[model samples]
Target: MSETILPELPQELWRAGKLELAHGVQQFLQVMRVASAGLGQYLAEIESRGVKDLYGYGTTISWFADIAGLSMGEARPYVNRAIDLNPTRALDGTEIPPFAPATGAAAAEGAIGAERIKQILEILRQIPAEVSVEDREHAEAKLAGLARDAGPRQVSDLGEQVLGWLDPDGKEPKDPEPAQPRRELTLQRRKDGYWNLKGLLDDEAGARTAAALEAYAKPRPVDEFGQADLRTKAERQGDAWVDLVDLAIACPDQPGTNGYRTLVHVTIGLEELKTGLGTACLDFVGTMTAREARLAACDCLMLPVVLNAAGEPLDVGRLRRFVTPGQRRALNIRDRGCTFPGCHRRPKNCHAHHIHHWADGGPTDLRNLTLLCSFHHRLIHHGDWQVRMAADGLPEFIPPQYLDPLQRTRRNTLI
Candidate 1:
């Protein structure tokens, strides 16, 4: 590659008027679109040169994902587009043409965007296999031309009409054996410590899974303070899945491991466990913040193994912070639900939070304890919000100064 000179950005953008700003936006978008087309060309060349031979990677998609700091799911589309819109060379050094050369030309000129390019390629792929090569080329040309002045939806509508014209009568129906139900699931961990879950389920299993998740995914009703649930549909569904997993784990009939119930172990140094100021290792998965470990330890969700400076387990007395079954029952009766003001989450979905954090020399007794749902628990721990047990023996929240200048104490009235 050679060094290339480019135009400088116009100065004092804040001084630009509305029309100038709009014109600048249009020009920059066209530049970006053309640059993206160039990137696709480079990607195709890399694929042709053999990503494994050049970069020592198993696949082009994984290599790009690593280089760009993106998940494989996010990088696959770019690789797929590059292969479709750029020509490739066969093993024998024979030059093969692009699947959608016309669309590629339009994209290179920045006349169409990613969405229209995708639409045009899909339209070309749907052309009848028996159609003459000349007819297929004509169809691609027409779709690319339609795409220059229209959005993806308009291009797709025209594509449907073109397909109908090519095959006025659809393929003849032939009787075949009834298909068997099939399902496959893939769970992979990403570099960011998050897991990606992708799956395919047959109709019956899909319907049942949808019904179960939907039952728990309903939006929380507006509480007494009129603050409605702000979680998006996808967020609600993700939380619902967590709820289902917890329910399954809580079942007594679940299989055990080595004569003990399947348990998650959190390993933390004594100082980190006491001060909540460092990281802790989680069993099977990865690490979590000491603050998160402290919170989980309060409810005994994960058995905490306190270690000394030499990295040996210490006798930290696990029962000291563990809330007994009777204590939990008493807590359920006392709080009825999350103690955070305006929250309507039930006891079953709440965690036992130590108002004066147990890690800070606070006793694990009723007076120092409160029930908080996961959202509010994180808010209390990570945000400016504060919770304390009032003189009346019930939990009360003190609003942060920014939320209320006077920092008024509020109590949940729904209980």
Candidate 2:
């Protein structure tokens, strides 16, 4: 193949008119498309020769990710695109054609962009296996030709039309037996300190879950401050899930292991728990911030196993931190709901937070305890907010200096 030199940027680019700038951008995009196609050819050759042989990496995508300073997920698409658009060699030295030769050709000419190419390739892949080879090729060619002038969405719409014309009826299931229900769930933690939850449930299970979540996910009533829940539907659902987990843990009938109620156990240093400045180990899971551990420990939502410098269990304080039922009822009667100003969270949705933490020798009585919703509970722990009992035997919050320079104390009048 002959080398093609790319054009240099126009001199005094800052002085270019609007139309000229638009024309320049179009020209540069065409150059990029051509270059992308050329890169795919090189990548195909590398794969054919064996990436392990050349770079000592197990996979071309992995090596590319490392060399290009990209995440594995970001690098995968480029490598996949290359393999799908370029010819490869079989182990027996036979030539294996690209999956969509017509699309690849259009991509090479810079007549289509990457998104359009992806749409065309996906359309080609969806063609029924039982369809004739000639029909598949014709469909692929038509999609690619349309992609040259149309957007990806238009190309996709045309492709779907072609598919409907070719097959008319969808593929029939091979098995005569009725399909079985499928239910699956996956929860994974990433290095960036976030958890990904994905799941699929059968119809019966799905309906039950939707009902449960919807019950708790309803928007909060307008508060004294005129603010509604303000959380999006998705955020409300997430909070509802947390509430459901809290309820399950608080249930007496919930299953247990090793003679203890099913609950998250956090192993934290005594200093970390006190100062909220280090990390803590979440039993059987991973790690959490010391501040979070402090918050989790305040209410024993996660039972804390406090450690000394020698890594010995200095204090478990599981039973000692627990507020008695009598005390909880009194707390609910007095405080009613979340003590945070304007919060409307009810007793069931709130955690009994120790004003002076139980770990710090604070009593578990009503005066020392207050009800706080999960959001306010986290805010009180992580943000500059403060909460305390008043002279009138009620819980009140003090806004940070920024919110109120005088730092005036406020009560939940809404309750």
Question: Which predicted model would earn the best TM-score?
Answer: 2
**TM-score versus the correct structure, for each prediction:** 0.52, 0.56
For each candidate, the alpha-carbon lDDT, in order, equals: 0.81, 0.82
Residue pairs clashing, model 1: none
What TM-score does prediction 1 earn? 0.52
Clash pairs of candidate 2?
none
User: What tens-digit string does per-residue lDDT give for candidate 2 at 1-415?
Assistant: 3355676677899998998889888888888898899888888888888899999999999988999899999988898999899998876878789998998898888888788887887777777888898988888888888888888678878988998988898667788997788999999998777799999999999999999999999987775446567899999999999988876766656566221223567888888877888998887478888887767766654566889999999778464567666777787788888888888878877888889986678887887889998888998988998988889888878888976899899888888
Instruction: Give lDDT tens digits, candidate 1, residues 108-142.
Output: 88788888888888778778899999999999999
Native-referenced Cα lDDT, model 1: 0.81
Clashes (N, CA, C under 3 Å) per candidate = 0, 0
Scanning candidate 2 in windows of ten residues, the lowest lDDT window is 254-263
Displacement of the residue 382 alpha carbon in candidate 1, Å: 1.3
- N/CA/C clash count, model 1: 0
Error of 2 at 357 (Å): 3.1
